[model samples]
Target chain A: MTLTHLNARGEAHMVDVADKQETRREARARGSVHMQAATLALLSEGGLPKGDVLATARIAGIQAAKRTHELIPLCHALALSKVTIEFTLDEAESCVHVEAFCRLNGRTGVEMEALTAVSVACLTLYDMCKAVDKGMTIDGVRLEEKRGGRSGDWSREPMPEPAAATSRDPSAEAEKPAEAEKSAAISPTSGVKIQFLAELRERFETAECVLEWARLPSRDIAGVKLALINQDPKYKALLNQRVLCARNEAMSQNEAAVAPGDEIAFFPPVTGG
Target chain B: MKIVINVQQDAFNTEVEQARLTEGRSDIGAIVSFTGWVRDFNERPDVSALTLEHFPGMTEKALHVIAREAGERWALQGATIIHRVGRLEPGDAIVLVMTASAHRRAAFEACDFIMDYLKTRAPFWKKEHTDSGSYWVSERQSDREAASRWEHS
Candidate 1:
């Protein structure tokens, strides 16, 4: 184990990379922003109110790569040769995947720069969409591969399967109690399915189910919101501001009513663009 | 006016910085200092760590310009800005801004002004590590608003 930034007195200091030989170094990192399907549609269709989400995120990522040293205290400032940020819009999984690559002829590895680019790009995506979907999550940010430096090249083991796709389905992973199955029982008439996504999933664990309100509570967005809060007061504060409610995968305001067979999803403001 | 800017990867000594600003200074009357630390929680709870990055040569240059601007805007005996880069945990000092002046207002305003400019103008990015994953911190609208107050003046 080596702590490069510590001196004889164990005080923190910048490591002197001045004596190290300059070599071509490259690194790749990846992360993703999970969101609602409707939000994904808005991003892909260029309908986000904040303008081009992908374009803005890409620029943010590239800019972050060049400024890595200024953000990380101990990093050596090197002139980066190239930086690239790419986004994969996976509609089926309801997420935007980000990957960044950084290259330079310098004494230090560019892994941190690459990781920073991916991180910023993901954050920019969240910022652009937060007003509409609050619960978007940024996850799995890691250095996928790196080349050059004294230790040589390294790469992460191949994942058994893409985690992004499976992570979107909270119901599959969450332990369901008898109460959840009872709530999931669909009535012959006037019943609707309710699901919570992202941050809401953690808050309303096993709260998702099918319900039949005699009056079809979804008649106004407020009715559904109140009902959910009534079911669990813990959800009241979250619903009041940061969380957004949706009907059948489309953005719905509190005034909008729910219809039978409709799917209701409650989520927080999306932070990923 | 005396200006000092340091960009490093290790932790800094606040007492040393305070002493440096007041050393051999009989003309100074008031000294103001501000230190920022990484918060354990931002937007979400369970933040495990934070990693900071920056542009080396350019970051130092930008900080110098910001310090000079503070000096020009206020009457001061000395000022210091020390920003740490690299991986930091919660409660670790991320930045230090200190100012000394004959009066408290100049030292106070200058210190506040420097931080406002530093947040938006500095070549730095921060990533928060949480239990579930890590995220890059979004530039806050509040930070922009704070920086913009100095635009007209």
Candidate 2:
């Protein structure tokens, strides 16, 4: 069936929810920002020049939840009853985990408000810390759970362990030490290098695929993936799935431009709560 | 031109929005409205619900820009955009776009133009949930193509 936002003529309109029953709705969302260890230290120590980073982010998130209707064009105006933003410092991972909760007694659910709060909080954190670490990455934004509304209640399933790091293919495991040594031997040079991460790393035993400047004429993500697949056809099926590409440790699209000496990585979609 | 943009987690009353657009405006001869609802399935048939996300400061700015651009291209008397964000079940309303003008053609075209631009330019993202897992919905190539046509037109 076509979406209700679209009329029979395929035009967009707001749905009339005056007849729907009001219910107490609550939702929670989580995301994380990964940064350098030094940057994390600065954050934990409250040494950031921006004063208190988490406090600022928490306020920004709350304000963002209140203004959600302003940001999303089709959202109805809702008076959110409660909005809370919390942060957890994972020192071992050098990451700050953000969680947002939103509540409203309305006809619709509050998941978006919660998700938006988490996203803005993460972005605010990035802005506050960019002076110290410009390489931080924001990822794993998703809805963790929701309650109330016509859908009853829903919760996300626990994510499986990343296949590449955990599931050791016996044959691949036996050869990994030698392959790791080979990868370690190849010093960083003024040439294109491709690395498999997470599950992809386990699938591709070589770990790193270093290419001479002459061989990497087309420095696009698809070209790099194609080159890797050419070296080993076993990656054909894996590459066909929805794999994320990154250039120089930043998330990028498949058509993103690449250059010599760039570090490229391919990994499965990130799943974190 | 009158433009109204709303973003909230509650469902909106289309009748009220439509009445507000045309109320006492004797000059309006035609009103075009569009409503989008959540479908149970996308890419897969098992989707139980959807979670939508948007950029806070940026989404409203983008929607206003699109509404203003539509006003410039068409002689619209009134326009309203209401988008919902949060968890939604099958058959739940997702969005509403309405346009009013002195003539049917202008109202129709303006509404279509706003929607096309909103789909691509808006910062909203959708994530579909199934029994086993949930995944962020990727923008379809067709949506990009649909929005690009406006650039040339």
Candidate 3:
């Protein structure tokens, strides 16, 4: 059976550029990951037991490029000439900046393949370190530049500032190698680079904050994951918090109970899922 | 004629393209160049490092695209792209694209055109590890907006 505009269930389509060129082609793409200071420290020291975060992510990025078809369903597998992944320490924000570049000599452009590499790399880091920090975010995955075929020449727009990804003093971080050395004993790895994230501390709030079981003696709040129905930019950071380890309070389902005059109704679980 | 992509190699720094483009003849008036470096920040002060990833078959394809684009947009004699991959420190040369044109305007504008589009549309993801946690640079609306400028112009 031949099917167009459908891959399996909903609908799918494959873009064909078979009539194009065999000219030399290359693309430069960049994306970024925002992480906590501790997480950055662990990565720099190469302390995470799961593996070298950057190395593994590097490998994953390549694999993701190869498997973009599987993940995205219709991407064409092209013979890639080269793949390069790099990591740079951003000391000011305690984060790592990842840039991926892919190349191929084929009919179709490799933008999706390049993007897939960046996406997979970020996800791998998140999966490996979600235990410690929850504010991790993936950003700026875009086509930095591309060349090849009938499209002739195409480039990305200029950022407001060339150093759009700004941060504090990271090069000086090497000065305090002692910090990394202290953590080195934590594992066979050498001392980790003690990076620092300089984001301001944020506050989390919710309209329908409630405990799952208000009546339980132990406060049966273990299995529930926190959710916010609607959030403005001011509190969007709250969504980034994976699991709050703080001694936070949760009211019963439906609505939280207020003491004293009991003027407000506690936020309850959404009426619908 | 010869180009290289380096990662902390002890071999050379010969920003040789300058001499190479000029070659034996000194008549070539302009050599436009762009050198992108790893900065210390990523919007948040806690960012400590950056990790760049690429697709093996496609990485070269994309660079070629940028090179070809530079050629098409300007009156170019020759151009080369040298982008390093792997772990890099702050101040390291992340990418170098150079164009040699008969006149300064063609070389300079072509070089700027290449970099402008590269910054916004290139499909590479950069993940920053900060003190607070690790996060991906959100896809920039500004980047899209920037790229859009070329479409109308």
Candidate 4:
């Protein structure tokens, strides 16, 4: 793709959209301000020394979205139909998820405006909370989705690390739980469904196995692992690595309680987003 | 109040689902809906498609629990959640959440709450396919953080 803002001589210039058709276009963007969890708590509770953190940030983002053309010199000034800013307080991640939506019936897309809104909102948050948390980081400012442009619509995909994606095969066919018949055969009577995922599935050469509770010497996770290792020496690798365990569907520890009907799953620390 | 949940591989019509929630009703003055779409790019560029994996039984169980939680916390007339599995292309609708109530606040908050819980608590995992290759999506720390905010709410 050629750069629209540069001429044949490579000098920065604005591309005229005089002949382009105006369509209803919308853009969504996201950003975040990472801070200490304690700082996030204070901001949420209105304990910040700076009064009304979110209110100030909200207004700032709206203003920024409207005046985006002024900030970016080459951007065309257009009347925006709508601009909205939203914030999600994530305590576990110690950050605030900021989202912005900008819409207009115009020749150019509103992606820059949406991105500017999110960026300003995150910066505003950091400005308000910096007194209490100096280490706050403004990050992940990017376009999420844009619709109604010549390119049609584009969205940001949810993805994992590129290195991991290229190095491994996570295709669906490879992930089908080892034959359902195999698991069924192992536990004709009372049994626990023992499933493997991701790397474990490839390494163990089985997606899942059902072990009869009565056949096992014990029923806890440790005992089940031992049984699998005894049944096939390859399963012994599970014990040496930092594999995760889930009972039913919830992550569990080795000593977590187990019963005949429980479903047990083993895998590497999840790479799912 | 009525609750409906679907985990499938089929595409859904937003207007059709919204009509179902407010069908034969005048008491519902507000209906809030959120739709999640598969995007073409993410941390890396040139993402062609996405594959979603889920634990068959647990995925349904988790959606039910999340819906029940929303029902318990809100004054609502109806709530419906639909999530799609399998391969999806850019611009495909992946999830739909709708909440209807007599007023806006309840419907809006409940819809937001359900999405927050679903992002972190759902059993589904995403694998992104790019021009370069494909890889399993990793859980986001921000997602876990977003879900945690509702624990005390």
What 10-residue stretch in candidate 3 chain A is worst by lDDT?
A264-273
- Could you tell me the fnat of model 2? 0.00
Query: A1-273, model 4: which lDDT tens digit per residue?
Result: 356788999999998899999999988888999999889766755667888888899999999999999999999887999998888777679899998989999999898999999999898998999898889989888876676766664444233223322222344223322332344346444587899876678678899898876455444688788888888899888796567777877666664445656789987643322
Q: Model 2 over residues B1-153: C-alpha lDDT tens digits?
A: 677988888999999999988887788999999998888888788999987765444457667768877876777888899888878889898999999988899999988888888887665767789997886666677776777888887
Q: lDDT of each model, Cα atoms only? A: 0.75, 0.75, 0.54, 0.78
Candidate 4: interface RMSD equals: 6.9
Model 2 chain B: ten consecutive residues of lowest lDDT: B53-62
Ranked by TM-score, the better of candidates 1 and 3 is 1
Instruction: For residues A98-117, write the lDDT of model 3, one tens digit per residue.
Output: 76778878887677788888
TM-score of candidate 2's A chain against the true A chain: 0.57
C-alpha DockQ of every model: 0.01, 0.01, 0.01, 0.08
What tens-digit string does per-residue lDDT give for candidate 1 at A1-273? 345678989998997888999898988789999999989866765667998788899999999998988999988777999898888777678999898989889899899899999999999999999988999999989877676776555445232223422232444324322323343354443466777654556556754876555333324567676676677687676556656665765556664435556777665543210
Clashing pairs for predicted structure model 4, backbone only: A92-B145, A93-B145, A155-B40, A156-B41, A157-B41, A271-B137, A271-B138, A272-B138, A272-B139
Which ranking of candidates, highest lDDT first?
4, 1, 2, 3
Model 2, position A24: C-alpha lDDT score: 92
Error of 1 at B3 (Å): 62
Model 1, stretches more than 4 Å misplaced? Answer: A159-273, B1-153
Task: Write out fnat for all predictions, comma-separated.
Answer: 0.00, 0.00, 0.00, 0.16
Q: Estimate, for each residue in B111-136, the C-alpha lDDT of model 3 and write its tens digit.
A: 77766666553334456667787655
lDDT of 2 at A264: 78
